[model samples]
Target: MSNMHASKLFDVKDKVVLVTGGGRGIGEMIAEGYVSNGAKVYIASRDIKACEATAARLNKQGPGKCYAMAADLSKYEDIVKLIDELSKKEQALNVLVNNSGANWGAPLDEYPDAAFSKVMNLNVNKVFTVTQKALPLLRNAQKKDGVARVINIGSVNGVDPPALETYAYSASKAALHHLSRVLASRLGPEGITVNTLACGPFQSKMMAATLEKFEESIVGGLPLGRIGTPEDVSGVCLFLSSRAGAYTTGATIPVDGGSLVKAKL
Candidate 1:
C-alpha cells in the first residue's frame, strides 16, 4: 500500500482531543501521539503538577499544542467543572478518551464492597458522566472529516477471566465495555462514535505490580513474545480517535497481541 493511502486511513490534524489520566503511562503516550499528529491535545487528571509537567514538555513539540487540566474523574461535579473550564478555553472537544480508572484484585470471597464501588465510580460512572457533560461540545463539533469519537479504555480481563483474580476490576471493565456499546448505539445518529479498547498485559504501573506476583510461565502462553507497550496501546487509540476510525463504532478493539485467542482451558 502507498504511504499516502495509509496516511489517509488515519489523520487527526487540527482536531481537539481530551484524554483523562493522560499525565503518564498509556494515557500520556496516547496524548503524545495525538499532539505529534497535529491535533491539539488536552490532558485531564487529578494530579495538577503531573498535568502541568506533561503539558510543558509536550508544548515544546511541533505540529499540535498540549493543554492540561486537573480534574478528578471519580466525581460528577469535578467532571462538570472540567468541561465548563475547557469550554471557556477551547471551542469544542473533537475526541474524548476515558482512560482514567482504578482496579482492585481479590478473591471473590475476600473482596470487599468498597473494592467494587471504588473501581466502578471511576471506571464506569465517570465515563458516563464525563461523556454527558461533553455532549454539547461533541454534538456541535465539526464532523466534516468524521463524527466525534469517544474511546473508552477497557481490559482483556473483562473478556476472558484469567486465573488471577481481579474480581472487581474485571467486572467493572466488562460493564464499561457494555456501556460503550450502548452509548455507541444512542450517540451514532448524533454524529458521535463510541468504542472501547480492551488492552492486555502492558508495561503499565498496574501490570508491573501484577507481574511481580504472577507466575512467569504464563508469558510463554501469549502468541506475541513480549507483553504490550505504550505504542501498542496508544496506536490503537490514535486510530480509533482519528478520521480513519470514523466508521468504527460500538466495537471493542483489542491491543492484546492475540492473547484473546489463547485457550481458555
Candidate 2:
C-alpha cells in the first residue's frame, strides 16, 4: 500500500465517540483529536458549562462535530442517564474513553476516609460501571472488519510509587489498569478492544498545582526532558482508536515522555 493508504489507517472518520470528563486536560485533547479527524464526538462531564465550552471550541476547528452533555460519573444513576441520552443521540458508540477520574493528596495519616472513598468510587468503580453499561452500544457499533474501542486513562503513579502522597489515587488507577486487562480478554471475542493509557505529567488542571510546585525538578528528571503535550496524547489515542491499533488490546501504554522508563533507572 502507498504511504497515503497507510496514513489513512489512522483515520476515525464518522466514528461515534464518547469521552468522559472531556471538558479539559487529557480528555479534551483526545476529544479534539477525534473531532479533528471527522469523528462525531460527545464530551461529557459533571460540569456542563465546561463541556459545552470545549465542544463549541472544538466544533469550530473540526471536520467532524462535537456535542456536550453533563453527567457525574461518580453516581451510577448519572452514568445511566448519560448513556440513555447518548443512545437517543446515536444508535451505536464506536469508542468509549473512560477519562473521568479523581485524586486526593495528603499525608497518609491525614488522608481522610472520605477522600479515599471518593477517589476509588470515581476512578475505579465508576470506570467499570460506565464500561459495563456501554457494552451493548459497543457491541452494536462493532463492524464486521472493525472493532470498538475502550480506552481507560490510567496514571504512572499506578505503575510506580508516587513521588507525593496520593495513595488512593494510585491504588484506583492500578485497579483500573488491571480491570482493562480483564475486560480486554472478555471483550476480545466479541470484537471489542480494551486498553489503558498510563499517562505521566501534562499541563492539565489536575497537574497544575504539582507542576507549579515542582516543574523544574520534574522536567529535569524526565528522560525526555519535558512534560507531555496534547499532541503526544492525542496521536496515541487516534492510533489506538483506528485500524493501526486494531490488533492491540489489553495493553497498558505509557504516554509519559519516558517517565516510566526513567523510574526503573
Candidate 3:
C-alpha cells in the first residue's frame, strides 16, 4: 500500500541520470530536481567550469550526489569520449535528458547559414548521436517494470511558430520532437521510453535577451499569466522519469503553461 502512495509513485531515489547542458538554465533545473530527490545526477556541459560550479552547489543541497563532466557534444569524438567517461563511472543509466542546445536569432534576411548549421548540429544531430551511443547503457538500466526513460527538452516555439526570428532553433526542436516519437516506437520493445518536453518561455540565460525585451508581453499572453519557473520544468521531468510516467511513450507533453493553446486561439 505504501508503494501505491503518490510519493512512491514519483520516487526516483538512487536512479542514475545524465543531463546534458546541466550547468545552467533548464538543464540545471532538471538536475537539481533529481539531485534533491535522491538521484545520482551527472551533469555535463561544454563549459567545465560552469558544470563543476553547478555540481558543487547542487551537491551541497542534495539528498543525492551531483558530478560534473564536460564535453562538447557537437563533435562525434567528444561524444564518444563522454560515453566512455560515463561508462567508467556507472554501468547503467536510468535516465538521459537531451537538454543541451543553442539558438541563433537574426532577421530572416540577415540570418547566416553558419548559424543554422551550428544550431542544427548541436540541437538535432548531437541529440540523436548521444542517445544512440547511450542505448547500451539505457538498456542495461531497464527495470523489470519497463521504466528506462529518455527525455528530450524541446521548445514550444517548435510547435507554435515563434514571433521572434530564431529560425534554426525552432526548426531543430520540431525535428527533435519527431525524432523522439520515432525513437520511442523503436525503443518500446527494448523497455525504454522516449518522450519530449515541449516547453515555453522560461528564465534561462538563453531566454534572457528575449525576456528582457518582452517579458511582460509574454506573461500577459499566457493563460497562466506568468513565465515558467524551475519547478515547472523539473516537475515534468520527475513525472516522466518516475513510475508515474512509465506508461507514457512517443508523447510530446507541453510544459508550456498553456502557451501553445493560447497561441492557437
For residues 1-265, could you state the per-residue lDDT of candidate 1 as single tens digits? Answer: 6645757667788888999998987788888888888889999999989988988888898578888899988988899999999989876788999999887888778888988899988999889999999988887674444458999999888898867877878888999999999999999988899999998776667677777766265466678856777678768877887667778999999888777887756
| Runs with alpha carbons beyond 4 Å of true place in candidate 1 | 1-4, 142-145
The prediction achieving the highest lDDT against the true structure is: 3
| Model 2 lDDT tens row, 1-265 | 7645856788899999999999999999899999999999999998999999999999999898999999989999999999999998887898999998888899987899999999999999999999999988899899533659999999999999988999999999999999999999999999899999999898989999999999999987789999998898989889999889989999999998888888652
| lDDT of all predictions | 0.84, 0.92, 0.93
Clashing pairs in 2: none
lDDT of 1 at 136: 83
**Candidate 2, which segments miss by more than 4 Å at Cα?**
1-4, 143-145, 263-265
Question: In candidate 1, what residue range of length 10 has the lowest lDDT sum?
Answer: 138-147
Clashing pairs in 1: none
Every model's TM-score = 0.93, 0.97, 0.97
Ten residues in sequence with the least summed lDDT for candidate 3: 139-148
Q: State the lDDT of candidate 3 residue by residue for 110-184, as single tens digits.
A: 999999999999999999999999988898899533558999999898898899999999999999999999999
Ranking by lDDT: 3, 2, 1
Q: Tell me the lDDT of model 2 at 93.
A: 93
